[model samples]
Target: MSLIKKTFKTIDELKKHLKTHAPTFYYSSQTSTVIPYDKIADFFKNKEMTLGDLSQLPCSMELTPTQNLIVKGAISWKDAKDFLRSKKRNIMTSPTEELALISAGAATSATGERCFHFGNLRSQIISLTYLNFDGNEVKLNQDIALKNTSNEVKKYQKDYAQYDIFKNAPFPRLETQTDLMIGTEGQLGIITEIEIKTTDDFPVNHLFILLPKWEVDSKAHLEIINKVQKFRNMVILCELIDANSFEYLPKADRPNKEMDAIFFEIKTQSFNDFYEQFVLNLEYIDQDHVFELAATKFHNIRASIPRAVFEKNSQMGVVKKGTDVQVSVSQFETLLKIYQNFTKLGIKYNLFGHFGDAHLHFNFMPLPNQVELCHEQLELLYGHVLKLNASPFAEHGIGIIKQKYIPAFWNQNTFKVFKQLKDEHDPYKQFFPQGFMSLEDHS
Candidate 1:
């Protein structure tokens, strides 16, 4: 089987082509996804399907007086950010990948630094237009939620009121049809345009705080984290780098290679008051360790760790294996303990990510022979986290690699709703046929 690549410059052209030859997989910049290359190649190995390149689509943006941004799906986060910056505005939250398209973010329900405050891409989307399975255009927005009169929706609301697909959402909310396209891993449709809410660009300070690993100094480390949490109102982003992950950090940035790090940002509108009260008053926090850098510089240093690990895995011919689990604030410490205890499995690993959201990435760097063992350990870990009521796949939606874990995440009742949604939106199963959930995994 061969994969044919097709590029579409306009929505009309895409819709026309889709009517005759529907694309099975879509590729834009492909810079942000963790889906393995082998998985994709293997998936298309036996099928003849066109791979649509959406990167060439219109990259336009229009900001309304009410701060709503109408953007074409092809625009990248970097371009969108630059456009927003010129207007002295910013999106609520975005992933770190600059080349990754904003539409990909919405499709994957992406989240990043400010997610703990504002929420994921799903929360920012006010409206969207997408091509359905039949090449027919469908538009959905907030207004549709009010006008929804379907019996299926009513039953879904009545039956699954207690269930939440995204467990870490700031608050519980009912699901609407519009929400289906946001995070179904591109299974439902192909998004062409989106309207997202934007916020004012506020000034902030980025700080990297070094602390001894919990195994080395638990009491002192816990105290520092507690102090940082006290100013939750002012702190926007708080991420961690465990001791094992320090090896991935650039040598110049690894001031204390043996110690862990917490990189956070403080809203600087009232910097003087916070500096005097927080930094000056704290004797435990080393003034020397609290280094301030520009937002870009800080993010680069933080991002370098994960990028290095990814490259290293590729070099070693091992598929990337990692967790995107997020638990309740109360269970966060327990999750940390479980991750740290994973070392007993004798597999090398690194842990880092959004500490504020109680979400962290625990990546396993396994040898070729250790891949099976690593997977067995991961299944056990998933089961344990499920017992703790954790979001097995948070922030990042369940792509191909994470599909096998869906059985553990969803029960029979919830699974039925998922299948029903799939049947309604993509009855032919043409879009990313192997992305999120498989038909056989339902039971």
Candidate 2:
């Protein structure tokens, strides 16, 4: 039996609670992005005295310390209001611990469209300049919008969740990184700043290499996957993000549809330099040629998909498609075999996800878009994952998105312990309440 059913609270009731007590602690942190990332930038900005619809929509609410943290320093009063129009884009969002403190303002049951609605007039971006004096330094921070319109994309073109880098000129070895950043689906979240290290500025070029999406009859590539492990030792901030909403991206918006891919990033002094090094160290050279090559081959391996493959995936958005849970990072290869088998059964999906860890992503066919049907599909999908010791809730936490998936990953005894913890924290059930259905609570 499901321990949690929707509270059936009207939107008005949710808004009133948000307006009055202001539950800024819980709702605001993780779920805010379940909102606007439209190409929309700002409303009105000026120093002259202005008047808002002050009668009912009074500015009666107060911003808590953390919510107000970047408001003042990151942007100006005018820009702050501009920032709020979206109230849902950027880097790390306002943590949840802050939102629960407020009465809880407007909450919704949806996901945000990341049309890349990020800008820095209200925000600023800077890079690390080491004293040891690196090579050419590229200092670029351009506005981030949904489509690749402006020329400043060089400033903001981030690699897909993962990439690689060779040490020097000869570039015998290679290093790469994967992504797993969290987003607040509905509550307000934005990233004001991010920092990375690079040697010199050069045109970042890429080869959109499309390989035959053939099934691996034998267990190969495990060696290259392991080689990446050693290279990861030199990685800085790498994470693997796996969300199911990727299947929802409109066909018109998705970049490359011909391939099941992975998102990864790499760095080099120049475009030519990167390609030369990448070719010389052919750790993954004949990867598509799977003839049982001893999995004990290379020392350093760099695996990745392409940027055109990545941008479209990001635009597809970040919410999960159904009530599927996340899995842990270990049981990946086993899960892939099951997923591949499902694919052969006409369960079409795009598999461009994080392979560095077990939190990989695959976009299923939206043939029957009904939530229940999708979830039924997920039940079977996650069943396979869990049967092999994988958890559906790997990177993303348990929210309404994965409420139906709690049992798939945890035993009843483990669920009981979580409920006890919830009782201790928000005894009044006033915080994030039932929205994310606590796995800790079996009651």
Candidate 3:
């Protein structure tokens, strides 16, 4: 978003205010965790002055906030393993293997990075698994996580919506960056901090709309997704919902009131009087209409017409494969139309994917009674995705789910590059022998 006005900074005043408030903490807390808020509190109590005296906080200024974790005491789940190792000082059972799997799996699912690498194992999951490290370690002035994390993530996720606009922009500019790591399949990471770059002026204001499920037709979806690239102040992230899966969500499994909601973080100028106008746009989409959505994590599969999600079973043997392809938006549009049209021909697809980047996440689960017909449908639908240049190995990596369908996206040249990289990094291929090492199938 472009800046409308100018913002001037006074570094001297910013430092003066900090010195008065935190003479000791201002120097010590820069690179350390577990900053005791009591130190700053004692300073504030002595100053007799309040926070409002300053014109504004500096752009690069940071605050240290800490919390007393109820679940694991002072230690957070992110570094829980460390606590487990130090039996005398800390208390807990080390679920090292489980932690690794969760962090590794999150990285694989979110960004499609192909390896369970060592760095990912320690850095990613170690931070995410810990309840205290995620928020309490930051040392906030108030007790936020004392309630819940989803609450904190959502509140901040919404606050930082405008930040993702600059996501494809600069690397060092992201202050609210969170890391996701997976070791053998585990989730690790936390909102380490939020940074607001030193721009002359902040983003202009704009309106954001949250569209409900039924309103997510092809025409509206494309319009919203395309607007991000077109309008500088517009932000959109549509979250698809599946009713067939929602009814099965246990009352406890569902997210907060804002769950299953898309965010349209707007940044524009002259928004002071446009609040009413923005509400009109949101009301048109029926944002107030709340519905129960289904998730693969807890949704029941037995009662659904065709089961989409399945448990990873030891009895299941997977076919190894590798593929990666990038498709143009126009070509992807054609492919989506074909798939959407086939839905009428008694063909069912478990579809829930990110349209913002033109990535499709689909699973075939034909009716239990129609075995022969189901096979034909899978071939036809899978083939269409391949022909469009859309990778079958999209967002979700080519895990045990669609390994056999690798050929649909990979050409001879692309396949060769993957094999070459595989050999370079993993000559022995011990970490994941089945992954991309399809010696028989590649031939």
Candidate 4:
């Protein structure tokens, strides 16, 4: 049967097709979770049996006159970004935006500052077309008006037993079905198509601030964060790179041996305004000192750190482990203290990420022998994140790797609601099985 035209009559049929045609869909035996299949060799090696070549999925991309892109779910993020750049337009989305959008249909990013809706991906979605668990097609309009009649309210009250859990939620407004599916991590349905808004490309002014090791823990760092927050409107991106991270960079790009750095990308139009309002007060830098670079070059330098870390781990035959933790801006100091403790423990790790949002990717490039120790440190790190009322999984959704932390992050009541939603939309758990929460027991 041609897989593209195959219409599944039952959930078992779908599972059978996936097992036969998409064997890479299963989770890793060691980790008990699914991860991205970036390398073709890894995919074949993990499956242990190659029935046939794994071909690219078919997809279509259409760009409207208004610059909106309507894309199929199978399109890779890099492809989408290339298409936008070809048209001299851009979507200020995170680096991992495409992975989540393709696999889960919804994703988050630190690039919200540049988005028209301020980083909420849902707001940029014009519509969605998906396949329900029962082999039915469903289309939802983003601007559809919802009716809240008494009967509808009663149904909601009855369906969601833990309504009280969200009673005091900051955004108390009820979410439409479209909103719910955006970040469900493919638990609800298979996203088939998406409509996304784009923005005209603009030049960005790059600024690099190198900080001494001592300032990482001092009040001076806090003052800098405060100043950045005060002028956030003018800054598009703010990232912090730890001293350890520089080890991964090329010799020419690495900073001073004892210094860490922060990279800022600000919209050039407001450069003068931001300089007068915030830059003049930055006590960390001397008044006459200034450092600048092309925005593209600055981002490339930042990207090289992770690339180097991964290459080092691959060479050592050890898996690279990392954590995406975000805490309240007020708790930045506490976050640094947690990082400091890890360093003191002799753990080999690097800290870098979107400091503008208090989210950092704590990547550990442990030697093969230090794998267990790396896991231990991750547990300790997550515990501290919870104590500070922060999220252990921020922009990255709870894929197979982070499924174990779901219970820790969400209360029983909240989890029950999640399960209920999953059950209602995907009763058999056929789509992206064990992505968010493991359904092994339930199955």
The prediction achieving the highest TM-score against the true structure is 1
Q: Of the candidates shown, which would achieve the greatest lDDT relative to the real structure?
A: 1
Candidate 4 regions exceeding 4 Å error are 1-55, 96-117, 144-174, 214-218, 255-258, 287-289, 439-443
Model 2: per-residue lDDT, tens digit, 68-185? 3222112222232334434432222111122221111111211111001111111221221110011122222223323332232222122111111100000000011101011111
How much is 194 displaced in model 3, in angstroms? 19
lDDT of 3 by residue, 276-330 (tens): 4433343235545423233233122212211223211111221111112223455
Query: Which stretches in model 2 have alpha-carbon errors above 4 Å?
Result: 1-209, 214-224, 233-263, 269-330, 369-374, 411-413, 436-443
Per candidate, the number of residue pairs that clash is 0, 60, 36, 1
Model 1 RMSD vs true structure: 3.0
Sorted on lDDT, best first, the list reads 1, 4, 3, 2
Ranking by TM-score: 1, 4, 2, 3
TM-score of candidate 3 versus the correct structure, residues matched by position: 0.42
Q: State the displacement of the C-alpha of residue 193, model 3, in Å, after optimal TM-score superposition.
A: 19
The per-model lDDT (C-alpha) reads 0.73, 0.30, 0.31, 0.58
The C-alpha stretches of model 3 lying farther than 4 A from their native spots are 1-109, 112-217, 228-236, 242-245, 250-335, 345-350, 371-375, 439-443
Give the CA lDDT, 0 to 100, for residue 272 in model 3: 37
Q: Which candidate do you rate higher for TM-score, 3 or 4?
A: 4
